[model samples]
Target: MADLFVSETQLPVEVRTHEALSTEELMVFGQSGVKEFEIARRFEAGRAGFPQSDECALAFFEISGRTRTVIREDRLAGGAGQPITYLGFPPARAAARRLTGQGVVSANSETTCLSRVDRAA
Candidate 1:
């Protein structure tokens, strides 16, 4: 196999890129070893009002019928990076509530997620 390498300081984001009629999307690697899909904002990089926060929303649904989320803090430039704990958000919390609350999941089934976009008028 060819050598696969990336800089040590950089993180490898696992993703599947897609372009649909409605929107572009990315299925990124999230918590619990499952996928947590989100709307693509690569085109908005370096823009003032980019959706960077939503990209870090790591929520997961597991076969054990439990859901959890990890919200990472913005990394500081000078110090050794520490992953800030996940704080609750509407999408993450709602998904967690689905798995643990009244909503249900089956072992054989896969968890499906949609990238709900935030638009400006």
Candidate 2:
């Protein structure tokens, strides 16, 4: 299984790869531990709008390293708009290639959970 790590500094721009189309088993890792799957964006979620907020963050999912899925924890109303926190699937290194034309950086082997979204904040 391919595994990678992205820091808060390397803001996610786009996800270009995925493991499989099956959502039967998917888990999102975040600071709060296992995060419930809120909603899956369009299959071509990558083609959607780019995360315009600088406050965007990065999240790691402990699923197939093949599926490079991207999920965002929305921000709360009236609060400072934060960057779209993206939950990248396993082996998210491909994101670099899509985000930037340059090659993807080696991610940390350790997989850290994503921070919980403060929608009520």
Candidate 3:
């Protein structure tokens, strides 16, 4: 099983990486004895018409070798017609943990559920 951790912050990328790494290392190593891991963050894209910038911290670590069957679907928008649903191959649903200053956040698998939006032609 692979674990993913996310943190929302306004700190610079470098500083955020260091902070998240320090926190994740301690938590993961202490709980599961994981030493090897990777940390990533999105870099600023210097382009026009880009939305507001929000920095985030992410960490990926190995927990165990486990596999599961699941389906992920997304709707594709195109010409004036019924939307098409794309089915993703059953992927290895990973178990993840998120660390927060106070404590772990809610662990419900589904974060947000959205209903289809209809636009009149």
Candidate 4:
């Protein structure tokens, strides 16, 4: 299984496998940068039996810091949902080349373009 970490500090975090996490535990982790979108993505991926490859692993961190904060607060307040508004236009794509046996290709091809997104969580 791939490891999970806090993007800002690269701190290692636990990955629960057997039991469901309590709401309190989720709240604490949320404070540390784990957003609902990431949790949902992981859950869906697991349900679909997708391989926990490094490429898919990096997609978990593709959320902008501002959007993360907003989503966190909205969840805390029990808000149904809201649209994300980026201050500016979409960011330009930069190739993250990786040298595989096949050839050089984008490492983060699955990355979602979240503005000002952090690297880890």
Poorly placed runs, candidate 1 (over 4 Å): 1-25, 28-60, 63-72, 75-82, 85-94, 111-121
Model 3 lDDT tens row, 16-59 = 24333443343354222121121211111211221211111112
* C-alpha RMSD by candidate, in order: 14.0, 16.1, 18.6, 12.7
Clashing pairs in 4: 7-120, 7-121
Off by over 4 Å in 4: 1-47, 64-69, 72-106, 111-121
Using lDDT as the yardstick, the better of models 2 and 3 is 2
TM-score of 2: 0.19
Arranged by TM-score, best first: 4, 1, 2, 3
TM agreement with the true structure for every prediction: 0.24, 0.19, 0.15, 0.25
Q: Per-residue lDDT of 1-69 in model 4, one digit per residue for the tens?
A: 222222313212322221244434443555322343343234324432333343343333333122323
lDDT of 4 at 15: 22
How many clashing residue pairs, candidate 1? 1
lDDT of 1 by residue, 5-65 (tens): 3222332232222222123222332343222322212211212222433222222322212
Per lDDT, the best of the predicted structures is 4
- The clash count for each model shown is 1, 12, 1, 2
Of candidates 3 and 1, the better by TM-score: 1
Clash-forming residue pairs, model 1: 71-86
Residue 35 of model 2, lDDT score: 23
Model 2, poorest ten-residue lDDT window?
A: 35-44
